[model samples]
Target: MAENPAYPVGLRLTGRKVVVLGGGQVAQRRLPALIAAGADILLVSPEATPSVEAMADAGEITWHRRPYAEGDLADAWYALIATGDTEANTRASAEAERHRVWCVRSDDADAATAWTPATGHSEGVTVAVLTTEARGRDPRHTAAIRDAVVEGLRDGTLVAPHHRTRTPGVALVGGGPGDPDLITVRGRRLLAEADVVIADRLGPRDLLAELPPHVEVIDAAKIPYGRFMAQEAINNALIEHAKQGKSVVRLKGGDPYVFGRGMEELNALAEAGIPCTVVPGISSSISVPGAAGIPVTHRGVAHEFTVVSGHVAPDDERSLVDWASLAKLTGTLVILMGVDKIGKIAETLVAHGKPADTPVALVQEGTTAAQRRVDATLATVGETVRTQEVKPPAVIVIGEVVGVGPRTSA
Candidate 1:
């Protein structure tokens, strides 16, 4: 294999013939991108998704309702085969190669001489994410990755047609813990100039409001202890947006480097031949407690603190938390999402020798205008949770340090 040339400019597929084989969802998905890239599309599929039907109704491309034929590859600039059968995709790939056309084999990238990178587009720029191992595990995974990139592009977090030369690109900006004002000055400045703002739900709406109306915004919000977007999707979105030469801001709650999955995105961008930078922000771990007038560390009461998530895997496996070690320590312990599992968490701490009456405070909606705080001992915290009906987006602090709250009420 040889090194692929850095995106060939004038060679873009404007007014070019592009043949897509397969009548399923993948073929349907590939059409719009090729169309937007100015390819004259011919979709060969026996069936199509509702989205495809809608596109065909709009007359965006020509549809041939049938299986692949030897003549399908004639006079085409590129081909994308997305069928259920690996054998069919392989056959289409071989024919395209024989005719010297670029092909993307939806099932097996190895079958094609070239592969499509996860891509993102903006005003004038087009960004793509290519892997050295294009023929690995599954092409669906590759397409799925590209889909996320497209979502960000559509929402405005990643822009394109950056300078012919590289410039400062993706910046991981912290959105602060649900309070737009708490965001750093640097974070706000970057967001204002951002071509795209890829944000998560934890990033407050107030912060999003800071961006001008025209600046693009994408919501990548993942609910804690519930359904979430896949990591690959998010990573690919970042790379694609940057490729378009737009200043992309990945707005995350708290600091991107801190437990924010920032490393995963950073690694993915580096692997795809794009460069990225990171910015830090205040974390909810300490800020939430402070908002409730509970100092994480005090001169006489607490010399240390610990922050842990109550995330448990789907298989009902044990948590990675060394509760025994944490239980014996003499520091403040802040647990995010420990509300539902407060009973279990309390049991583990007590069993590990932490006193049952250790002071614990549950801070709900911390840092927002509607913040609430409930103070209790470790033994009663779970029961108190049940009685008070405390919901998530809450933080739990357990230690003697919690007893030393400010005299005023939270």
Candidate 2:
């Protein structure tokens, strides 16, 4: 009898039983996706890799810790035959056939009832590619095609040339340091769909050049502001553009909620009944220091790290930071936008009780082509900043953890 062709369908297997007859590398690779789909998996392998054992110990899956048997697929909605022993796989497949459950064979695709396709998602679209032709059965070939399509959709090339049905709303995107590649996949997709982009000075600027020419790009630095109502003017611009039925993207440097005044924009949008979406970007604080070979927190060297804004001097009346309390911390202290006031900040911390000789690393333009670092003690960082000419948008790490990574000093 000729075998029936395999059909592809997405299974909503939440809370359903799935029997897996392997405990090797292939099983490890497939388990995470099934777990993510909320499937109840039963593993019938005697010995497993450390990662699989860890998952079982963590209560992620039910591990039988033994070989497969006739009744293994009795209550399973689906079964997978992936063991090295051909007899074991044959037994499992027979049991699945008797139970009328779909079985997938990793060793022999021709003998399997189901085949897993290479899958990816772009925005609300889910892409699943399967090879039906005789020469297209290679999983590697299928995955390569899938990745190319996903990348095209991400970078905006696959999208339609005309965006006629664009949504009128606001998207606050974090550009993630200065490298264009560091931006999130979702963020890149949104940029392709944007009609208007209001970008900041410190955000990823390279991506703006790649956007379609029809897309309006506005530099936030060039936007005129009122004396004390600059934020208000910016908020008005977003609302005005959205009301005109244009999708607006307010692209900032790092995470919008973290000192980016994202909450203020959200509140303003809510007040005016405008729709808004926020996409988070990797902050330069941790990533920049890391690029400069400095760990903010090391296992035994330091246990915690705090990221603070140093735009205001410690003695200034408008400064809300409790500099006195910061000096008492025994962990890492990361200061952003404090290059100009490094001298005052260092003096304040030293006076309040922090060690004068604590290691301080200033990572400038981190994670970018022009990234550079300068090292000094808390007592001498202000002078070192002057001598080395460390520029703005730098991350300063003040703690013992700075010595944990290689090249702590520039």
Highest TM-score model number: 2
The positional error of residue 336 in candidate 2, measured at the CA in angstroms, is 0.7
* lDDT top scorer: 2
lDDT of 2 by residue, 1-410 (tens): 23444466899889999988898987898888888889999999998889989889999999998888789899889888889899989888888888899888888777777777888877666778888743338899899999988888876667654445766899999888888888888788788888899888988998899898899998877778767477887888899899999989999997788788989999999999999998998988888888888878888888989998999999888899998999999999999999999899999999999999999988888888888888899999999999999999898999998888788335
TM-score of each: 0.56, 0.76
TM-score of 2: 0.76
Error of 1 at 92 (Å): 88
Q: What is the C-alpha lDDT profile of model 1 across 1-410, one tens digit per residue? A: 34454242234788989888886778666778877878888888788888887777888888888888778999998888898877777788889988998877776655566666666654344666665564344556656777677655544344333345547479888777777778876677677668888887777677676567777898774413234357777776777788888778899987786668898888888898877878788998988888788899999888999888776521237778788888888888999866888877887788889999898888888889878898888788878989999888788888887777673335
RMSD of each: 18.9, 5.0
Q: In candidate 1, which residue ranges exceed 4 Å CA deviation?
A: 1-168, 222-229, 313-318, 407-410
Q: What lDDT does each candidate get?
A: 0.77, 0.86
Model 2 bad stretches (over 4 Å) = 1-116, 151-166, 226-228
